[model samples]
Target chain A: MNDSRYVSTAQVAEVLGVGVTTVKRWVDEGILPAHRTAGGHRKLLLADVLRLARQSNFPNQNLGPLFAAGHALVPAHVQDLEQALFVALERGDGDLVRSLIQGAYRRGVPVDDLADGVIAPAMQRIGHDWETGKIDVFHEHRGSQLCVAALHELIGLVSSSAAGRRPLALGGAPEKDPYVLTSLLAELVLRQDGWQVVNLGPNTPLASLRKAVNELKPRLLWLTVSYLEDADTFLTEYRQLYQESDRLGVPVAVGGRALTDSLRARMPYTTYGDGMAHLSAFARTLSPGKRRPPRGRPTKQSNG
Target chain B: MNDSRYVSTAQVAEVLGVGVTTVKRWVDEGILPAHRTAGGHRKLLLADVLRLARQSNFPNQNLGPLFAAGHALVPAHVQDLEQALFVALERGDGDLVRSLIQGAYRRGVPVDDLADGVIAPAMQRIGHDWETGKIDVFHEHRGSQLCVAALHELIGLVSSSAAGRRPLALGGAPEKDPYVLTSLLAELVLRQDGWQVVNLGPNTPLASLRKAVNELKPRLLWLTVSYLEDADTFLTEYRQLYQESDRLGVPVAVGGRALTDSLRARMPYTTYGDGMAHLSAFARTLSPGKRRPPRGRPTKQSNG
Candidate 1:
């Protein structure tokens, strides 16, 4: 392992919101493990520091600098992180939300879990709050916008690690569906599964998607329908899109809140995903070749 | 002025893609200006280095790292940047597109100019190429995806500087209109002009927007109609939306390719922005309190 993946004593102190002397004391007390550089500067593995921070019950807010540091992969507890994200998002703290989510991903929480387990639930609760008048529309909008911003940041991170040669998956929300978050989350989940995705984003027409199928010939085409203005029209247009994709031998994956059992019953697709985890599992079956992690994949350790 | 805004000689060399010795030589030869720290380490003004980069005809590609540096502001030639962006988008170089656009915004190019003068034109050409069969659909999709990604990055950057107390502008593309770029560009322009925008994004039904207006009571609303599947329905729904906004005392800004002269004559809007520049100017009129840049706005120098 590269020693450079380890951070200096000063960085640990800064990340944990403590003094360097305290960090040194922790190292000396065997509370944390450390190695010494040639100049005798104590270098601690980023993972160890994170573990100690977790055990010592350090506030997740203090881990903001750690997340922004973009250091080594250290697996994080998913339940603790989900709760942290809920609090951060509720407080309208966009920076904290970003740090928590990005930090978890960097530390080896899979993107699908981040989507299905963390962000989706957090946003669902926020949406519920908005519906019940627990939060004002502006507050809800702000929270959603912050989530979109965080997801885009995650997309950039995932894209940087992705090999562009992977099988193409082109997708977006169908017509009259203006939900940006679900589609973005879907893109992130598929991207993490090693598919090169061309996310058309929200409100893509079925006709345009058919043209995309004819031209781009993506290996997979996904539709995330969060809202449907005219279900009859959607069904009709979707039938045509399905025919086009079938003709091109491309499998269609459909999901989202609006894709109720009745709606999905009429809309035929190769797979119906209830959530990002389902989509991720389906994507793996499509391209088992990419089941292996990309080269230079970060080493991760579970609590077990 | 904060001298901290100035970067060190080594930073200048790294940004310029040159050696430190060469940068030192340039300073000594009076080709570039520098100030000395107490330890005699040379600290060059970032603007001067950027100006030198432009004048010396350094390849715009080499400016990638400079753009990523995110340091001092220095005015850049917009035409040169437009050309650079066009090439980068055509080549599917998303990172370069991001760096060029973000760099210009950091260096004092208004978001509207970046939207109108740089990104819009570049994207128009790419769209034109796709129509003429000069490029494959995958290439066009890739380019558009890259633009979306870059714009989102700009949104995050602008939002960080936004006060969040500004007038809210809630809007998106109306139903059957599935364009993402124009709406996102509008959000960026409005945000730069001090609007806390809640961009509902593409394919939003006018009825739902009416609900948002009722609840949010935004100061302004914007609709970018890039593609309209049914003009008469849009006209009817938009009329209802206009009446609602009028009752709520919210100004409506409308623009996009689908709004032809005849269509526009039938559609009522507080203002019809032909492009982002017009939107920026109109936003300024609504909130002159924000005509001045935010506090700690970077001091920028122009080559003129």
Candidate 2:
């Protein structure tokens, strides 16, 4: 296998001589470990892709450059700060949450890292607590609100929001999934990477996502599924969306806790790993240095 | 009917010589039509209530002073401004939407009225367009984001957001319903009535709702159902919530388009009418003089 850290599910399917449906079933069934993009695309790790190929009775092959590695970008201080952020959220301290977020950004912790490492995990913890009955509903809801407010504040602070043609990305949660925090966090991360983003917010239907893809012709699309009770329906829509947006060169990224391993393999799109860092890395690779042109210019995105 | 415009489902059930469940069955089974409150409580028009009773073979005995009336509260100018708001939303003119809202508030169109009449209708129309194919997914999503942004701006503009000791109201969409717009609008409405609100946002579970009621001892609790694919599941939770919170004096107000006539009857809670005007009026009647002393004071709510 040639050098590349990430391979599309399609690439793996071809190598295995299996249909995309079978590949997706593998991912969904946890046969292959994969990551999802913010746009709901699935990206397979090189090792996992090769593993799937071998498991399907293919000859063992040496994967050289294909197995690229991603180094950690978030520092220890940033990790510590994430804990502080969580405390503030649990306390329902909007001001404290804001302060910690602002301080992190000031300290040079990338905004997206803050989202992926701090905000996302903190919310997950809170959610877990709610599920386990450690905290009451009021506390959980309060934590959710504080996180939203913090992100809203972070999004506001982005200096180089977007002017015109700076590698635009658009996405949101699928319909029936009201989780907007993930999509909003992705928006912040993309903005920090200097990509102008349009977040479709929570409970977004496929019709709307398709409309956005057509109208915006975004360079990258983000789809996150935080809630997934109706897997069959969601899978059908995901597959349909992947097929519909095929003509466009724009890459679709799908991720979130909802993407089971087996499900990821079945998805025909790129999968993003956990956190804003992976997404940021993906953005860098897709359109390297796209954010360089208009550094620190506060302006609106002109219609392309 | 003693000069009351509304009656609880319990009263209706008593008059019909049936259990509350049976009365709810009438509503749920399409034998009756009723409305819901923000707190998930059901309230029927006195006329409707009486009609239900009569249809259940209720004695022709008069409801007497038990029946009352609720007058319309939305003004003509507010209605006209609603049309203007729709135009702005269609144009995706964020600035114009903001300016129109600020102007409306300045001209004495209460913030809640703007929510109920202007913003809600405009959003509904946009949603309708999307449903009918007058617009595509992009337009609908864009329209939704615009409405959210507009409300955020309006919420920001409300001076003296909350003062101490005001009637506290808490609410959000039920679990799996990611629609937070309604919850936010309800926040503005409650705040205008001198109620300090904690909007739990969308997809809030009943356990959390119960927790909120216990902690806040709020005067009112609001629950909205914006999207409901799992009717049986939603109804089960709604009914359970009503039962669980029965001990608390805090009235659970349930309202929204998703509250079908039968669904509202089955759910034992106060039902609110369409628009913020009705909600604001409900707030006033729920806690009269709550806003009188702090009238126009842009201060944080003092604890009662």
Candidate 3:
């Protein structure tokens, strides 16, 4: 029980092979085990810091910098990206928001994958923080604006890619859903899955959606409603739309957090309960020409 | 588009073969599709009601009695049970609480599976509701107590089941986690998977967990942490525990939302991301004597 032992933040940084700023960030995020000296400088426990260094893939150095960078080299970084995006949005810093999305995309992060991995989680956290009064409504709105802009930019990048299978997939928030994050994510996912997506954006009118379907002739129509209270209104309109669309032989997929109970039962279209799972299933469906291997085939694949 | 009709609650209920009370409850819970007339009575579209009736797995006549009893034969009735348990907990109605647990158990739902299927989902809904201010703090606490009591009762019943295999399993809240619902679900899942679980309950000190491990000699320990802030504390303690326990030849299995970060790092030890998947995996691990037939070899038993 050598509790008397201590190490400098620099030593911790050395152990993790990261810079002092990174170590400080780790301390700020509470990733590093630390104590403060009488003069208020951070002190690290030698044994604990060493253990963390070993556990973290910090390139065989002190763990301080890696901790500060908020678990860089892992999906955990996405969490930080999410926070940064939200903060940038709150401040209405369009430049910062654009930079973040561009940086992630340049790093080979798929726009759709980024939506699922980074944007969606960030939006969820922002909403939670706002609801908990950890953040104000202004900040939430700011974050949303930034999100919309980022989506717009990302959608442009998507348009540059070679279109794969479907001509178009339409999705957006039903009239009552204020939060369009799920819809945005769905649009990004479908676009990446090689469908030309006509994103109607949030709170699109039902009549407009029907008109869009008639005019755009999307191969699939996707609808997202995040409020259960809106389900009846949605279904009432949906039944009419489904009747008309069914004649055109287009399949409709509906999903959102608000889907439960009679709403789930009453909707004749396909429903997805979870966002990412639904997107993955949709992607699988769109990946044409890939067949399931016959039974008993030995296969070797690298670990992810 | 015949805008000429609106269905009364009775007519809608008649179509579903359910009592108006049940339809109202479903509406209140945002489970059913309905609207209010000028006088405020509920109205349902005929097509929507029929779709719900079909989805509920009830004959038109049966719906009336089921609705009268405030029940529906939906496959996810187990989810409804969870909601009811949480609602009873929220209301602090001890009688309703006790009856739901008893009914579920006596109805041949495995006590543990009932916990997983009913209790966990209910708790999630409760948490979400509480966060959204749809339910108050007192209700949340009441719901938590009911779930804890239900788990206790189920554990007792499971202990008496001679037909069940009991693998040694440990359960406890990860550091800083106030919510015991996850740990409770883990205990139920383990028990349902035929593992005898030692539920250490909420917020056990790390040292106490170590001592219990030494005394109980459990083959596997389940740790759950939900809050992001607690991750650092849990990880530090868990690393030490893992090191010490590994020497004693015991493996610790961890899950819950907290394990999300740990998954990316490829940490040592097994981690379950999904409760059902985790339970099935644990069951498979325990039942090593069972094996699937070679691929493409048709056996007398159908794997399906």
Q: Lowest-lDDT window of 10 residues in candidate 2 chain A?
A: A290-299
Of candidates 3 and 2, the better by DockQ: 2
In the range A1-304, model 3's lDDT, one tens digit per residue, is 2123565676455434345787777777787778897789887765666565344322221122223222222223566676777666655554456556655654445565577667777777777887897755445544664565456445544543342454667666666555656776776666555566556555556665776677657677887777645556778988887776787877778777677767678877754546655764665575463435457843211111
- Which of 1 and 3 is ahead in DockQ? 1
Candidate 2 lDDT, A152-230, residue by residue in tens: 6566445241113358788888877767689888887776655666777877777668767877788898888888878
How close to the true structure is residue B190 of candidate 1, measured as C-alpha lDDT? 83
lDDT of 2 by residue, B1-304 (tens): 2223566676565444445886676677666677777787777666776554444332221231122122122123666667777777777654456556654664346677778778888888988987898987667676677677556545544524234466777788887776677888888777667676677888788766877778767788888778887888888877767776677777777788888898777678765666667777787888866545445743332122
Q: Against the true structure, what is model 1's DockQ?
A: 0.17
lDDT of 3 at A102: 52
Give interface RMSD, every candidate, in order. Answer: 11.8, 27.1, 31.0
Q: What ranges in model 1 sit over 4 Å off?
A: A1-65, A68-109, A121-146, A157-183, A189-304, B1-77, B160-164, B291-304
As a TM-score, model 1 comes out at 0.62
Model 2 chain B, poorest ten-residue lDDT window?
B65-74
1 or 3: which has the higher TM-score?
1
